[model samples]
Target: MTRFGSRIFWCFVTAAMIFSVISAAFPTKAEAITFTPNFTISSEAAVMINLDKDVTVYEKNPNKKMYPASLTKIMTALIVLDNVEDLDNTVYEAPLVVFDELYGQGASSVGIERGEEVTVTDLMYSLLLKSACESAGILAYHVGGESISNFVDMMNEKAKEIGCTGTHFVNPHGLYDPDQYTNAADMALIAQYAVENYPKFVEIATATEYDMQPTNYHEAGWAHIYHTNSMLNRSSSYYYQYAKGIKTGTLDESGRNLITMGSRDGNNYLLVTMGSPMYDADGNAVYLHYEDHKNLYEWAFENFEYKQLLQAGIEITELQVKFGESSDFVRLVTADNYSCMWLSTVDTNRLKETINVDPSLLNDDGTVTAPVAKGQKFGTYTLTLSGEEICTVDLVAQDDVTLSALAYNFDKAKQFTSSIWFKAALIITAVLVILYIIIVAASKKKRKKYRRVKKRRKF
Candidate 1:
């Protein structure tokens, strides 16, 4: 081979290397694909939401209204914690009429006898952990000024205040009533509010067992009261390691319901499952509600993770600037850091970001003007997954762009001189001036010729 052949071969190799580098730097847009986990649950309505991010992770029939059963006690307990001044000092006696109504309806009880003296603290434990219908009545009767109906009204009002749109309570015990119903979404929100506001609620709900102290009726004390939520008990087969304090509900008409909060790796999730099948085919009662919760928590903890998608002060994109002092463009970044729960296995390339720029900040030529201040919000970027928007972040200037007086004046002058109207006027003025000079010179020369002709004729 000649020397020229060797040079050509090296040039080809260099060209290939450059092409490879460019391809790696800016890859082609990947097809948008979302990872949807294949998980099945027995509950008719179920929902899971991230407590920290306040975003829905998974949902099915979340807005469908269903019977909440004993889950009503969650709101009942919340109101008691808010209005009741003292939990240990306040004492109330169980009324015979309350027991009569509860017993006739075949409601569950913590064995509160008529005229039995009990403190508010014991009743709360019984109300939440044991799902005692009578304990709820006593608390309501004492705190609601001897009217359980008024207490129910407060529960409904509190539900509305907590952003519950599909919930209404007719009784504190969550007894079956057509008017008393709540959806899975509403119940999850109610549980979230309860856990965030009252720490005692979580303590009582998560307890595996609580001993009721000595009361007037039972001098020795009530037997060891166990939590009705099976997930909290380690001995139970449905026990979940990450299960936290929440409430459960069951009724012949409503089947089984459960509201649960689980924490793993410093992340908390709220789950609600309603209307699970009460019985299997063999005429045996099945705890499908607990099973549903366990499945969801396990799947979520295994697959999802908290991810920081946008960080403050990190450049996201560059915007071209007109009449800028330091540079021709400026970097735009998020105003605040945003983190959300997302599937850990999902490819980050599939996440879509769309920037919506403010028209006032952009010129007609698709460039921004100078004098942009640092931290000024100029646009918004919406992050989406599978065509659904998850979050929106503000796009702010990463650095301050000072106004350049020299550049500004030069731009103004150049704009004026380059205008079509200015050029047309200048051409018209030049043409008029040239025509005047030519006409004046011609007239003077003709006059001179005429004078010379007159002199020749006289000679």
Candidate 2:
């Protein structure tokens, strides 16, 4: 072959190799369509979170405060689990005062009478399975050292400890009180804490029914206390196979509320719905909470899948550097891999990424100091869909950047020379020099005139 032909062949071969490498590193991402649940959300506040991935997929007024109703029992149960050491063996006696207060307020009851003795296990089942407000009172009264008020205080403290900002409890039973309220987001946090910390809570809340056997409070064991959440009952029309144990709440003032967990095909989620319509337009009972939770779960399961939206050590953006060893730009990347359950139909590119560089990262001149470590976190970037936030990832240095001593010293010297104090000193020194020169010139002129006058006199 001719030399010219050989050169062309080699150039084409090299170009092909480079293109292949670039293509492999960044394979083309297939576009996906964004999906929103087609069904209407009747509840005023609702939020659904993926437990395994730790991300929220759906939210409507998640942080708005609303009545939690019996959902407050989840926190009440959490406090009980923490205080009570034995669930079955530690028996408590129902106080006459507790009975009086519950009856006076018309709170739900598990048929406990004054001076009745019951085990902690029985009370836990009653609180969770039976929605037994009286059981809540008994446990609180006992655990709180014969003071229901003190137990309510503990509940508020626990809610704060669990990172619930919008939750405040004036009573343990979750009956309507103007001051006692929580938002869907806050309720989700409380529920997640209970499910993760107390397995016993889940076991009881998930039960279809519990047999309240013969105790001093009850002569007949046939008083079957059933779970208030219909999702757990197989015979109920709202029964969902993926649904598991949690809690529910209802009140004329608060409407209907529900906190439910669903796990299907290894994906687990918690959904909280509050302030749904209690009655249909015709004034009959409405169960929109159940319908809303079930439909949202199915929609999420069908449309969502875990996707790796960001990779570690990949340069996301660059920031100005003042004392860099070689270049004036420092590249930043996320320290850890970022992945979330995203709508399967939505294009990954549609996910909005917003970079928030630290305001302090740059000086007035808009440059950061050098010597940045390989994995130092500089700031963070948040991922969102439409307006809803998914997660925040720490933006870190992609590679180590050594400080240049010479450049740093030079910059400091420049800064010092340009300072106001230095300029003021320089101006004063210049004025002094000018004054000294003028004084010396005046003295010389006077001496010269004196010499001239003396010479004229001699002549």
Candidate 3:
């Protein structure tokens, strides 16, 4: 090939290399709102999270304090399950005063007779499925050492333990009290705790109809109750197939509250809606909480999926190395796998990344020093979709780069010599030497002139 031909080829190659480096340094970025709810949520506060990935997909005033209503019983059931070891074997007798405490207050009940002996299973089912006020009182009275106030204290304590920040329970049965209130986010955490920790909790929460077995008070399936949540019922218009057992809360002040979980095709999500209007402007019954959750679940199930955007141990970029004899640079790869529930319509390659290496690890010239070990974390890169940060993963050394003692020492010596302090020292030393030489030269010249004067005797 001619020299001119080779020159043109090298110029093209240099341009391509520069372009590649620039592309990696500044990635293409697009910001799109991936999580958009299909319908307006009529609830005042709500949160929907993908339980499988633990990601918040939609939220509206999630932390706003609102009345939890009957949803407070979810925490009650959790405390009961925690205290009761043998759910079916242990028995507790109802006190006569317990019946009097719930009498004529417009509280819901399963008609427990005074002084009736009941098992833990019966009370649990009744408290959860039936939303029975007396069962909650009896369970709290026994579990709290016969003190109802003490049981509410236990509920509040458990609430704090499991990360409920804005929740305070005054009663276990969720009777409307001005002091009792919880937000959607805190309630979701409480419900999630019960769903995750207790297996039977889900069984009871999802049961459409629970038969209160022949007890000392009731006989022959006479005391059966259905779940308060309409989403779990197949015959109901608001029935959703993927919806599972969770608690429901409603009160005059609180409007309506619902905490439900949905699972479809290996994806599970938990939703909590609070402070929804029970009746529309026409004064007709409106189930906005249930419908909002149903729409949100369907939107999540249809549009999103888990996609592996980045894989670990794959070379992502190369970093120039100083004092490296074995290799001029080291390769950086992802430290861990980053899989996201990305939009199905978008391609993973379109997702932009912004890489950042630790400033301490990098040299002044934008290169890293040697002595890098494999799997050593050096930096992080954040992935974004439509301008929203999706996830950040650590960047690690792909292979070990041994440090060259000769090169490292040479660089150190060069740095020391070029430093301001060393340069100042050198200037002071040179000035001192020049001054001493001038003084010595003057003294030698004076002595020579004196000798010449002494030898001349005639002058």
- Number of the top candidate by lDDT? 1
Error of 3 at 350 (Å): 5.2
Q: Please list the residue runs of candidate 3 whose C-alpha ends up more than 4 Å from where it truly belongs after superposition.
A: 1-34, 345-350, 405-459
Q: Give per-model TM-scores.
A: 0.80, 0.71, 0.79
RMSD of each: 13.0, 15.3, 10.9
TM-score of 2: 0.71
Weakest lDDT window of 10 consecutive positions for candidate 1? 19-28
lDDT of 1 by residue, 1-459 (tens): 234444544454443332110101111122222234576789999888878777678888989989999999999899899888788888999987678678778888888889999989999999988899999999998888899888888998899899999998888998999998889989988888888889888888777788888887786655678888888888888878998867889999898998888999977889998999999999899987887888888888898877877777877788888778898888988777777677887776887988777766677897877777788777777777878766677888898887687887666656655766456545655666667678889989999999999999999
Better of 2 and 3 by TM-score: 3
Name the candidate, 1 or 3, with the larger lDDT value.
1
Candidate models: Cα lDDT each: 0.81, 0.80, 0.81
Q: Per-residue lDDT for 447 in model 3?
A: 100
Which run of 10 residues does model 2 get worst, by summed lDDT? 19-28
TM-score for candidate 3: 0.79
